[model samples]
Target: MDVALVLIGLVGGVITALSPCILPVLPVIFLSGADRERRPYPVVAGLVLSFSLLTLLGAALLAALPLPPGTIRWAGLVALVLLGIGLIVPRFEAILEAPFARLPQARAGRDRGGFVLGLVLGTVYVPCAGPVLAAITIAGATGDIGAGTIALTAGFAVGTGLTLMVFALAGRAVSQRVAAFRRRQRAIRVASGVAVVLLALGLTFGVNVPNYATALDHEFQRLLPAHVPTGSDVPPALAECVGQALYTEPPDESQDCGPAPALTGITDWVGTPVTLAGLRGKVVLVDFWTFDCINCRHVIPHVEDWYAKYHAQGLEVIGVHTPEYSFEHEIAGVRRAVAREGITYPVAVDNDYGTWQAYGVQAWPSLFLVDAMGQVRHVAVGEGGYDETENLIRELLTTP
Candidate 1:
C-alpha cells in the first residue's frame, strides 16, 4: 500500500507531537485564566489548531524547499538550546534587561479575535515551544514531500490535545492534588530541558542519520550487471572494495563461510528454527531484513513474487529478522509486521544480529543466494537483481 512513505510521515508527526515541550505549555493555556474559571475551550482549541497548522506549513515547506538534509536538525538543536537558556531564567526582568529582549507583552487569554488571534498566540507561543517544534519540522524535511511534516503536525496536535483535555477536565482534581502535580511538573520540566539538550546533541553529531537505507539502495543499484552472465568488467579490486564496504564481505573461495553461529532469538519469544540446512537440496534465499528500514520495504514485492514462482521447483526463502530499533525487538510487533506485509515464508528472529554478523551482512533487505550445496553463490544487498536472482535460482534448481 506504499506504506513506507506514509509510515515515515506518521512517525515524524508523532515524534514531534508527543514531544515533552508541548505537554507542559498546555497548562499555561488553562492557567492564563488568572482566577481560573472553567478554562476557555476556544483558547485551547485555537492553540492546538494554530500549532498544527504551523507544523503543516513547516512540513509543506520542507517538502517543497530544496534544503540540505541535516539543516533542520541543526536548527532544531539551536532552538532547543535557546529555549533551555530561557527556561533557566524564567523571569521577565532578566529577559528585559538583555539588549535584544525588547519583545512586547503577549495578550494572555484572548481567543475570540478570529484568525489574527490564532496567528498571534501561535507566534508568541513559539518562544515557549519553538525548540521542539523546530526539531519536529526539521525531521519532516528528511522525507520526500509534506508527508512527514503533516504526519508530525497531526500527531503533535493529537498528543498535545489529548493531554490538555485530561488536564482541563481534571483541573480541579489536579488542583486539589497540587503536591502530585508539582512533582509531576518538576519531572516534566527536567525532561523538557533534557530533550532540548539531546536534540542539540543529535543535531551536532548527526545521530539516527537517514543514510542507512539510501546508502544500501545506491549500493544495490551499483551492482547491476552491464550484460547478462558477464557482469561489469570493472577491475576486481574496485568491485571487491565496494562489495566489502556495502555488504559484510566479498565471496572468497579460501575464506571459510565460518563456523555457523548459534542463532539467538528475541527474549520471551520462542519460534522454531528456519535454517538453510533444514531446506537443503533446495535453492535457498535468505533475506536479512528489519521492519523500520524504508529500502527494505521497497523490494518486498519482487522477493515475494520470485518466491511464489520458484517455490515448487525446489526453492525455499527464509526471512531473517534482524531488528534495527528497540521496539522491533518485540515479538508481537515483528509478528504484526510480518502479517501486514503478507510474508508467507518462514521467518527467523535474529534479534541479536548473530545471523547478520555470521553472513557479514550490514544492510537491511540483504539477500544471500545459497546453492543446493548450501554454498553462498550470489549476494545482493538492498534491492534490484530480480532477473539475475531468478535466473540463479532456476539454474541451481535445474542443474541436477
Candidate 2:
C-alpha cells in the first residue's frame, strides 16, 4: 500500500478510538491493565489479532455472503449487553469466566484473563472510522482484496491496538501508585458497566454516534489551514462482479407480474426524463436510494456497474433519488451527491414522495426490474440480490 493510504488508515483508526462508539469500551481498556500483578501485553496482542482478522474477514463476508447488516448489528448489541451485565454482577462475571477458564493460559496470572477479555472486547467493539474505513470496506466489497488492502486494514488495527495499549499501561501505572484506587476498582467497574448499558441503549434506538463524530472531525479540520483529505476522493465506480452469492438467487425467467409505476413529481432529472410508457420496449431497473445512507452508498457501485454493462444491450437503469433526511430534499444537495457518487443514469428526483408512493417503496436501496412490456418482473429491497436482479434483467432482454 502507498504510504498515504497507510497513514490515512492509521489516522482513521485513532479517530475511531476517539469516536463515541468507542467510549463505552474505554473503561474496559482501563481495567484490563488496572491490576499491577497482570501484564497488559498479552491482552493488547489478543485485541490486535482478533480485531484485524475480524475487519478483514467481515469485509470479505459482506461482499461474498447474503448476510444482513441488521442481523450483525443486533448480534453485536447482544454481546455488548452480556458483557455489561457481567461487569456489573459478580456472579455473572464468574459465569462468563467459565469459558475462558478452559483455556490453558487461564492457569497463568491475570494476564490470561486480560487476553480473553480483550478477545471478547475486540469482537464487540464497533468503532466508526468514517471515510477511510469506508473506502477500505468499499474496496473489499468491490473485490479489491489485494496485499495493499490487507496492509491498510492491518495498519488501522495496529493504530487502534497501540492506542489501547497506551491507555492500558497508564492504567497499570496509576493502579500501582494509588492503593485506594485499587480498593475502589469494583465501584469503578460497576460504573463502567452502567455506562456500557446506556451506550448500548443509545445505539439500539438509532443514535448515530459515528455521524456526530464525523461532523466534529469536519469542524476541527476546518480550523486548520491545510486541506485535510477524508478519503472522499475514492472512486465511486470501483465495484466489480465479486460473485453472484452476495445477493439472492436468480429466477429462471422474468415473470410478467403487473404494470410498472410512472415517474411522477420529479423536480429535476439527471440524465433524461424517463417514463414507464417510453421504456416499454427496453428492460428497466428502477433503484430507490438516498445520498446520506451508508447502505444506499454501498449499493451504488453495483448499480453503476449494471448500468455500464447493460446500457448498450437495451437495459434502462433509472435511479429514483428518494429523500430520507431533510437535507436530501434539496435539489442542489441531491445534484452534488449524484455527481460525487458518479451516478450517470437517469435519476428522477422524488422530492414529494409522489413516485415513491406510486411504487409502494418502503426502504432505501430498493430495486425493481421491469420487462420490455412495462411489467414488474423482479424486486429487491435494501442491499444484496444483485445477481438475481441481473438475471431477471438478462432474461427479460432475451425474451421476445
Candidate 3:
C-alpha cells in the first residue's frame, strides 16, 4: 500500500467535498445533521464504508448481477424518499424505528437510521474525476481493482466522509442552538424533509441545479495529484498537473501535436454550424465536453470568461458537446445547460462520440488548443491549468 497514493486520494476527496460537484447532495447531508438527537457518526461511517466498496467493486458486481444500469443509484433515491417521508410523518418515522425497537439503546435517537441513510446516499453519490480519482476510475473501468486501488479508494471515501461529517456536525449544532431553528423546530424539520424529498425528485427527473461553486472547485483541484513521482516527463512546475498527458514533452510556445482532427458527425448544432476550415486564421480552443459533467461545468466558466475577453481579439472557442450519458444527448438538455451556463459560443452536439473519437479524447472537459494554422497546439484534461491555459491562449493569439 503506497502511503502517498492514499494521501493523494485523501486530499482529492477533501477538495471534492468542497467543490461544486458536492452541491447536488448537500441537502441530504444537511438533513443528516439537522436532527439534534441523531448521531451523525453512523451516517458518515456507513457513507465511507459504502462508497469504498462501490468504488472498488461496483462494476464487477453489476456485471455479475442481472441488474440494470444505475439500479443502486435509483435504490438510493428511493431510500431518500422513504427517509424524507419518515421525517415528515412521525408515524412513519416510528415504523422505521420499529425494527430496532427491541434492541439495546432503542432510546438512542440515531441508532441505526443514520447508517442506513448513509448507505443509500453513498450509492447515489457519484464523484467527479480529479487527478487521483481518474486513476481509481481507470483501474475500475479496466478491471484492475487490486489491493492498492482498494486502499486509495478507502482513503478517498474516508476523506470525503470527514469533510461532510464536519458539515453535518455544524448543522446539528446550529439546529440545537440557533434561535431561528430552536423557535420553529417542527416546522424547520418538516421543511428540511421537504427539501430532501424534492432534491431526490429533481435528481430522478434529471433536472440539474446550476452550480455556483465552480471557481472554488477550480482552485481546489490545484492541491490534488501529489503522488510519488513515476519518472514521467512531466516538468517540475507541472509535476502536480491534472492527469497523464498525451504530450510528455515540456510546454512550448510553438507546441503542435499535428493538424487538428476535423469536426464531423455532429448530431446537431447549437447557435450555428461552424467548421474548423471556416474558423481558420483565428486561434481556436476546441473544448471537448459534456453538459452533465461536473468538471466540464467548472471548465466552462473559465472558457466563457476567455471567450468574452478574447473573441474580438481573434480567439474562436468551439465547444464540441459530447454526451456522457443518454440524457446529455438530448438537444433540449444541451440547450438548457448551455443557456444555464451563459455560453454564447457555438456548441456542436456529438452524440455518437464522433468528434470525441476523432480527437481521441479520453476524458470529459478536454481542451484542445489549436493554433491559427489549425494545428493542435496544446491539450488539457480534467480540471486545473486555468492560468496556464489562459496564458497559452494569450501566447497563441499574439504569436504569428
Candidate 4:
C-alpha cells in the first residue's frame, strides 16, 4: 500500500509537471545549463532538495498547526510575483542578491549562485495540489510523520526532478546548436517570467485548480487496484457457532475487565444508546471514527452492511465519533456529515474523548468487538482486518 501511494505521488508529480500551470516554469529548467562551463548537477540537486524539504515541512506544519488554507497559497503567490519581477528586470536581482553578498566568492561561486537560483525557482514553482499531493498533505496534517509520508514526498520530488533534468539537458543542446536561442536568451527569460507571474495570479485569484485536480485525481484512482480487504474469507471459529472460543488463546475470564464504559461526553446521539449492561444478550461492535478521516470513511460501508445484515440477529454497531479537527466538534457539522455519508447506525459524538480514553484508542477507525457477555473479544486498528473483524462479530452474535 505504501509503495502504491508512493507510485501515485510519482505519477501525480509527472502529471503536474505536464499541466498548463507548470508549463511556464518548465523553461526555467534551462537556466541551470545556461553557463555550459559550470556543471548543472549542483543546480538540479539544489532544486530537488529544496523542493522536497519544503514540501515535507509544509505538510508537517499544516498537520501540526491549525492554519487557514489560504495563508500558504497567498505566501507562495507573493514569492512567485517577486521572483518574476527579479527575472524580468535584472536590476531587481541586485536588490534581491544583496542579502546573500556576504558569502565567499571562490572558484565554486557560480555553482553556488546557480544552486541558490534553483532553490528559489523550486520553492516558487508549486504544482497544482492533486489527490496524491493532498493525501501526503493530509497525512502530514494528521501528525503522521512516518516513513510512508517521507517516501511519497521523496518519490514526487524525484519525478519532478527527473522531468526537469530532461528539459534542462534538451535546452542545453538547443542553446549550443541555435545561435538565435543564445542571442534572444533575455527575451526568453522575460517571457517565461511573465508566464510564471500570470500563473501565480491565476492561483491567487482562484482559477478552480482544485476542482480540476480533483477530477483528474478521481480518474487516476479508478486506474489503480482496490487496496482494501473484503470479508470473503471468514475464520471457522467465527463462521461456525456461538459460545465457542473465538481465539486460540482465550482471554483471562477472571481478570474482570469491568463493564463497558458508558457513552459519556457525547454531544449528539444518532440512535438509542446500546449500553454494556443493557445489551448483555446482544453482541456490540464499537467503532472509533471521525467524519473527515479517509480511513474511517473507507470502512463505513462494511460496517453499515454488518449492521443491516445482523441487527435483527442480535448484533449492534455503535459509532463513537471522536473529532480530529475543531470544526467537527459542532453537533450540526457531525449531523450534516452523517447525513451526507448516509450513516443510519447509532453514532455517539465523543466531543470530550471520554469514551476514546476509556478504550485507550489511539487512531481513527478503530474497532472493538464486544461479546454477549459484555467483554471486549477483538480489536483492530486503521483499515483492513475486515474478515477477522466480521468473523469476530459473527462469533459474538452466535454466542448463547
Per-residue lDDT of candidate 2, residues 262-344 (tens digit): 77778888777878898889988888887655556667888899889889999989999875433355677677778888998
lDDT for each residue of candidate 3 in 70-119, tens digit (9 for 90 to 100): 57667778988887788788789778877866666534656577777678
Q: Residue 261: error of model 1 in Å?
A: 6.6
All candidates' TM-scores? 0.41, 0.51, 0.68, 0.48
Residue pairs with backbone atoms closer than 3 Å in model 1 (clashes): 13-151, 13-152, 17-156
Residue-pair clashes per candidate, as listed? 3, 1, 0, 1
Candidate 4 regions with alpha-carbon error over 4 angstroms: 1-9, 30-47, 62-69, 104-131, 208-400
Which digits, one per residue and each the tens of the lDDT, describe model 1 over residues 255-323?
113222233443332235565566668877778776544456666767888889889888888788875
RMSD of each: 17.5, 15.7, 6.1, 11.9
Better of 1 and 3 by lDDT: 3
> What order do candidates take by lDDT, descending?
3, 2, 4, 1
Q: What are the Cα lDDT values of the candidates?
A: 0.48, 0.64, 0.71, 0.61
Model 3, C-alpha of 308: deviation from truth (Å): 13
Instruction: Write the residue-wise lDDT of candidate 4 on 1-400 in tens digits.
Output: 3787577567767656655435546555665465454345665667778667656665456545676533454565676677668668868855766676777744344455556666655655555434355445445444546777787787788777777787778777887888876787777667656755775675444342211233343345445442211112323332221112111222323222335555666766876755667778788888888765555666788899998989999888889987654345667767776786778888898866667656645445667777788766666555555777777677667667
